[model samples]
Target: MKRILWITLCLAVMSSCSCRQEPEQVALDFLQSFFASDYKQARVYAAPEIMGILDKSQSIFDSLTPEEHQEVKDYLSAINITVEAPEKIKGDTVRLPYRVEFSRLKEPGESFITLRREGRNWKVYALE
Candidate 1:
């Protein structure tokens, strides 16, 4: 019984330690939420500085009429976004590059997203 208890404790510890999600996944989730007009959910992934900015602004979707909102959603849906793996650019900072493609666009759009390590979690530091 003691041996079994010890094994169970070790497994629990391992699982708990692995619970943190990858930074790239967090960035993708943030983008998905932002584009889907779920600012509340998107804010969860933002760092405190970014969250403050988001809090001060009116909802990007809330200001639009229903038709406009639909149009925006359609435009976002029509675009294809691809996020690359994050690379450490400096201490506690990572740079993530992603590509955005649209049928009507003459060229794919590319941008770098920044992330910073906050305690055990990664947060969205900036979007550029």
Candidate 2:
């Protein structure tokens, strides 16, 4: 009976951990939608908690000057984005590490992004 209980506990732990998604894959999918400028698709992956914040972000984007919009788009387009590592999943959140290579710029940089599991899907929280 004790051995059976131990086996059951081990299996339960393994199954729970198996359900985790790879953070890098989640980040890549989100970035693809972002680079495509598809906010609608992107929103499908946003955390419910940040829906209001992202909506406000859309308004802020609408307020950007034409030149600024073009500049940001142009700058981002020149970079190659790749996920470097997956951070640990904690509670409702998972943080992913990424690297950006700028083809047109002299120097490039790396950064991290976070994703939170919302319902059955993972949403990119914000990039930093």
Candidate 3:
């Protein structure tokens, strides 16, 4: 019984410690949460700098009335964003390329998210 308990405890700790996701996944999660207006969830994947930017933008989002905010969210929900595999990885940083498509867009716009390795985790913090 003691050995079984110890093994279970070790496995739980190891699994939790290894929960860090890939940069592409972090970017997708951050973008989705941001678009959904779920700032709290987005913060989990964003770096402090990105959070600063998001906070400022959120202030603008906040200025809108409740109905306006919902309208904006509805519009954004119709847009489609496709994330691709990482296009570049150097040292401890990675660039994940993605495409954004919407009715207003004549063609998909290409962009990339920049992530830096922070300890065992990847943090989404930049764009290009």
**Residue pair clashes in candidate 1:** none
lDDT of each: 0.81, 0.72, 0.84
Kindly report which residue stretches of model 1 are placed more than 4 angstroms away from their true locations once superposed.
1-4, 7-11, 52-58, 87-90
Error of 1 at 21 (Å): 1.5
Query: Per-residue lDDT of 88-120 in model 3, one digit per residue for the tens?
Result: 667888888888888888998888888889998
> Model 3 clash tally?
0
Q: Write candidate 2's Cα lDDT for 8-74 as tens digits.
A: 9999999878866666777876676666555677676666665676677667767889998787677
What is model 3's C-alpha RMSD? 2.3
Q: Which ten residues in a row have the lowest lDDT in candidate 3?
A: 81-90
Better of 2 and 3 by TM-score: 3
Off by over 4 Å in 2: 1-21, 63-75, 87-92
**Candidate maximizing TM-score:** 3
Clashing pairs in 2: none
